[model samples]
Target: MGGKQPVTIMTDQCSAMDKAIREVFPKSRHRLCTWHIGENAIVNIKGVMAKDGFKPRFDYVLKYTDTIAEFQHYWNSLMTDYNCKTHKWIERLYDLKEKWCPAYNKEWFSWGILSSQRSETTNHSISRRLHKTNGLCDFYKCFLDVIDEWRSKENKGDYNSSTGNRYYSCADNMLCFHARNVYTIAIYLIFEQRFIKVIGLRCQRISYEFLVSEYIVGHPTKDFIRHVVKFNEQEMVVDFTCKSYGEIGILCSHILRVFIVHNVEEIPKQYIMKRWTKEAMNTIVEEGEDRDNEEYIGGVEGDGNVSNKYVRDETLLDVIEPSIDTVLPDVVEPIVEKVIPTMIQNPPKRKRKIKNGTEKANERNMRPKGIVEKKRNKLKGWNKRRERHVDNLREETQSTDKCMYHKFTCWWGFGSSNIFKFTIGSICSR
Candidate 1:
């Protein structure tokens, strides 16, 4: 990371790793994986887990508590009721609660990841392709294959994001339209979920000072868990107490509710993270870099007016008003006519050709089959044969129970019959 340590590092609970992180990256927050913690609980508290309602209560304490006070209250109650107050593993977990507890780690930016399960999943995939007897060269080759598969998946996602059309629940909202154009398909879906949640939320402004306003946002039924949103009217910036945007780079539902109340047309440019956008892979020029050869600015190509690309539409009136005094009336009319026509001209839409029934059937028949389809057909055939064999054995056992019983007692005298009877019994029982 360019010699800079990450803000947070998540790992399974290990004393050596904990010591190393504390020594090497003193400033970085070290987090314990919640999945590992839960897995450890199965081994450490098997007796407690066997009791009714213990698992659900444990899960609730681990995941649902949102404040330090709430966590402490529930944790103490759990320990008392479960009689695990003196349990060694539970005591150790309590000592490191800040590392694994959601309430304690909420302020940190983790990209919405609560555990290292994603890395574990990748490891599982790699392990399936590897062997204990594999050589170093074979291992390297397998690693490259895994990397290529990941890149292929990324390319497929990019293709879908670029070409796929998504249905918007709030089709009339300008903010939703702006999100659809700016964000990638996956990120847009996540944003849309938050946008849809705005319908259930209610926002009320509590204070106003200068250009800043503070609002309380929450659902009608949940008055106790309200979120505070602070909005700056001048800068068009919003801050939520949940810090969801800081952690995940996506605005929370509470902030969106505030925007709806204020009649905000589009998400502010500052809030729209470039990493989540469809143009995430586009080359970004740094400040003081040469831009003479650059053809595009703000998605517009070959535009001579560079200033307009950086300025917002609402601020254009202010800019043009000051320049009106210096501009000649004869020159202004021609400039307006030339720019207005080019700016408003819509691109021509492609005509769609409806396919007939025969044409569609032919296209389907001509489509090339892949290895996956062949494997699926082979699996289906195997399953059918197995089912038939089981049914035959079941019927034979039911019809010839007396003969099978005699064969079982006289196995030495009738070897083949004994083996057949054994097979029939096993299959029927299964």
Candidate 2:
């Protein structure tokens, strides 16, 4: 009997995806992953209160909705109380009633369809592989390797390649070796293609010194693990240990060093790996694949390399910010956008202006409400806006605290007067 008992696939209950799959698999039914469905319903569909007030109502809806009548009853009550009749998410859900009501499609919907524990299980398991990575570069390499390897395993293929060619997955078992991976890398180096395929690797003169300088701008932790450079004072050989994603592999750093420091135009071949190479990327393989399209992994993935122009990481989000055309309005610079506080409309101009005799407020109490206030009310009035209109001469018995503009025939006032008198006298003589 050729039949699939069923393979459970858990994904976020995104309507676009559900709709897309719905169009393709008309006969193949889908039960919404209830936990994700609930999450989406709460986050995108309905809002649970920010405070804990919404918990009982949310729990009531979740618990009582095992059957369609119960669900509808609770839903109607909720809709009435929250004014959810006008809510777009609730309207949309009702529009797609067939997907939500279990009784409407019992063959597809069941207790197995809902998954709340899977997420918790996955989170607990993630800690088993935590706290690793020697330096940033090595961590990124291992990071890419892990993704490719996992994707390949998930797809049951070598790796997902953009190009129509096949490439084997870079074995991420290397991540397990990490700081010990150099000895393991030497073992894989015997494969010959691993290091010998590039000219920079063959020549050995690319800047082993520079890549080991640790130009990594921003990383929160891992101060002990850094760029290691052992210069051969005698033989003139350099061994640079570079780290990325928990692995410290021996890199032919000379080329990367030269390119970084000297601003060399040609990227050395020694730096070419399946991760960024077109061949590696095209085939999702450890060898001969192109992976440039995977820039989204580094750019939007929110890794910390935002400070480095060449690197993108979550902690270093600004590093990638300059690289991407963050198309803000030409008039709206990001710096200005960040610094400028949002100006709110000044409380809608009090449409019903205060009528007279409403309070103990006196006309004397509110005299044009000078832009600045002589009175010490905290709400500054228009009186604050006034600057003293300075006069030319000081009052008799000149006050010690005289305005500087009128201190003693202010030069500003007298200088112009002298010029005016001279001009007038010259004109009369003429």
Candidate 3:
């Protein structure tokens, strides 16, 4: 990314990848995939999982804990209850608690991604189109096709975001309106969900510093647990204990409730992530620096060995001039330009050769050749036989029906309704 490191990197349990990330991008926050950790736990602590109430308790400790103290408390309780303190995998997970545990790593921005499943899914899709027999060239072509499909999807998303009409749950809410205007379609929908959820939450002021006030927000009757939200009235900055904004770039319902209580009409600029915005792909170019020119210079100045003027000249020559080898041979060109038109204007007629009587007889006696022709003839003969059999069966059925009708009519009497019914029944039986 042009000498820039990622803010956070998530990968499966791989020691080599962990070490490489630490060495190469020391500043980046490296996290293990929670999914991989869970899978490993299933393999490592199968006995613990088999015990009653262990799985839910383990999940609570892994994901639902709000604070580090709570996480530690519950984790220790779980270990003591399950007698898994001596487990090697559990010990290793505790050692790397900040890497995979959300309670410890909530401060860092991760865009709500807890696993490297996105990359894995893309790899799976590409692998579906590939085989062991595929060469490097075939792999490259498949890769290009996949990339083109991704670009097309991105373009479609962009079009939808730009052209689609905004949906409003509460048309009068300025915050919702502002969010709908600012964020792209997908992000706006997420924000709208959170915004709508604010109605269910109750916010109470807990404490206040110079400009920042903390509030405890939760449902009145439904939920017992409450979340803390710190709001700066002067700067219009809000921070939720859940760190929903940090984790997913979207304000939590607790924070939105706090905003409503504080009479905040619009989301603060800092909280509106640019990546979620409609103009995310648009870059503001500097007044004097042209991006195309810079790219050209960068291409020419690669390794500092090539001259820019020489590169430009070569590029121009390649575009403007055709190679001598690409020109068609003069003799062949004349046949295409001259002979093709003459042939089209005066098409040659196929001449029928006169044959002797013996030759004609031999031709007439000749059997159809080729594997395809023989198969076709065999299929045709089988179909004809089937049709003849069907016709014979239909004739036999008709004769049986006539005989049944005559017998029924004689037994039931000619003009009676019982006769008609018996005849119909006999025909059906036949």
**Which candidate ranks first by TM-score, i.e. highest?**
3
Give the whole-model CA lDDT for all candidates, comma-separated.
Answer: 0.71, 0.38, 0.71
**TM-score on alpha carbons, each prediction:** 0.62, 0.26, 0.65
lDDT of 2 by residue, 330-389 (tens): 546865766554434232232232567364322343334321121213312321232111
RMSD of each: 22.4, 35.9, 26.2
| Candidate 3: tens digits of C-alpha lDDT, residues 184-252 | 776776677677778878776767889899876766543323566788899887767677677788888
Cα lDDT tens digits for candidate 1, 72-115: 75577668767899989889889999998877877777886778
Ten residues in sequence with the least summed lDDT for candidate 2: 389-398
TM-score, cand. 2 vs. native: 0.26
Model 3 error, position 346 (Å): 41
Residue pairs of candidate 3 with colliding backbone atoms: none
Locate the minimum summed-lDDT window of 10 residues in model 1: 357-366
Q: State in Å the error of residue 315, model 1.
A: 55
